[model samples]
Target: MPDTAYNLTVGDFNCTVFSDGCLIDPDETFGLNCILIEAEGRKILIDNGFGENSTGTAGLLLDNMKTVGRKPEDIDTIIFDHGHIDHVCGTFKKDGSPVFPNARYIITREEWDYIKSPPGDNETQNGFYRHARQYLLPLHDRFDVVASDCEILSGITLVPAHGHTPGNVMVDLSSQGERLLCIGDIIHSPREFADPACLAAFDVTPAGAIKTRAKILADAARDGTFVFATHFTFPGLGYIRQINGVFSWAPI
Candidate 1:
């Protein structure tokens, strides 16, 4: 059975992380190890796991939500770190309707565009990109597309960390003097912290991704911020610290 949902209090607000489901893709597909986050109450699901593989495996999100006393309708915001399949595939039901009827969705404008006009001849090589456009395009009318850095709610700020995708972003939450940074796929593996220059083969622009990852790590380390990586191993929460001018991630 999956572990019970966990919560981290950020001042007066509570940020709970849940598992939507588990997937076992090729190591090359991930390039680095990762897990997804399913947060509840003031609910913000960071990403939706793959639904294409098997209904039981991909749709585990609803079950996990129920386990925590949350229903699909209870979700307020569905934040897409980027429109990758593992991250956004669960947004719709089997009937192809919005899963979170009442929640407003958000994604970087750049990412939205890239998937809309993906590079040709690269179609098969970019399965997730293709899936994102096909599935998410219909829901475009429901999105609150953001182009610049700004606050999404009282304790959450969207930090544009482009490169992985044109408008890939990270979420920052600050409350009661405590802060947490939800970095979406910035570093696929925690090990990347030991070598920030290491790039995932899937990165749209590997070099740009490296720079962005390093910058976010540096900032998080300096502030002693709690870090949430969408694709890190289970319980993807951690803290980044700088040692010898290099950043390292320590799970919290």
Candidate 2:
């Protein structure tokens, strides 16, 4: 098996980027990257990849974690960037039990509401929402929904960049002077880094996605901020570059 876990640090916090596996489609391939932040005494997991229910070459989060000496039960907090099935479905086991039983879940209030009352019925685009609810609703009372742009911890911040989903957010981590911005589903394909107009089909709000992508790509390039993308290549650690007025991705 290939190495799926990449360990690093964000200032004082120990961070690891785990590959939940990849989604290979006829036209494109997507890497599922999840982040684990060990801060103080907290074990924070950014997203749990597709669990048990996934079909093809995905759902490797649990095993990847195990290789790093971590387990589902060892997680103390699970912060969801959105309610997409691939990001939230791994919260439950095959028997419908919570995978991270000891962890408290956190998500933007806007996202939680969207999950409960999705855009349409099961037959429509709401199928993903319906599937997500099955794994999330059981832990309804365990979620601590907060407003967008909330600071999750001392160095971890949830920045609102809604577009792909009703309440999608980005994780911004700052420590000492170094910074890393985890743009969840913001630019699924590398080409989008240079062309913000290249929208993914799943983007619920294409206009918002384009606007947010443009802004983020510009800002990251200007500031030279390290970025972690959810669906980019494995480990997805890189810097956004801007020359003249064009943007591009520079993997490190």
Task: Encode model 1's per-residue lDDT on 50-146: one tens digit a residue.
Answer: 5443445444666666776777787777778788777777787655677778877888778877877856565442875766777788888888887
Worst 10 residues of 1 by lDDT: 28-37
- Candidate 2 lDDT for residue 201: 61
Quality of model 2 by C-alpha lDDT: 0.85
Q: Candidate 2: lDDT of 90? A: 85
Q: Which is the leading candidate under TM-score? A: 2
User: What lDDT does each candidate get?
Assistant: 0.69, 0.85
Q: List the residue pairs that clash in candidate 2.
A: none
- The list of candidate 1 runs beyond 4 A from truth reads 1-4, 28-42, 52-59, 121-125, 195-199
TM-score versus the correct structure, for each prediction: 0.85, 0.94
- Residue-level lDDT tens digits of model 2 in 1-252: 347999988888889999999988787888899999998889999989888878868889999999978998899999999988888878987888888879999999888888787456435447667667776877888899998899989989999999878799999988888788999888888777565666456677778889888888888888888999999898999988889887777888
The positional error of residue 63 in candidate 2, measured at the CA in angstroms, is 0.5
Q: Show pairs that collide, candidate 1.
A: 18-38, 34-231, 35-231
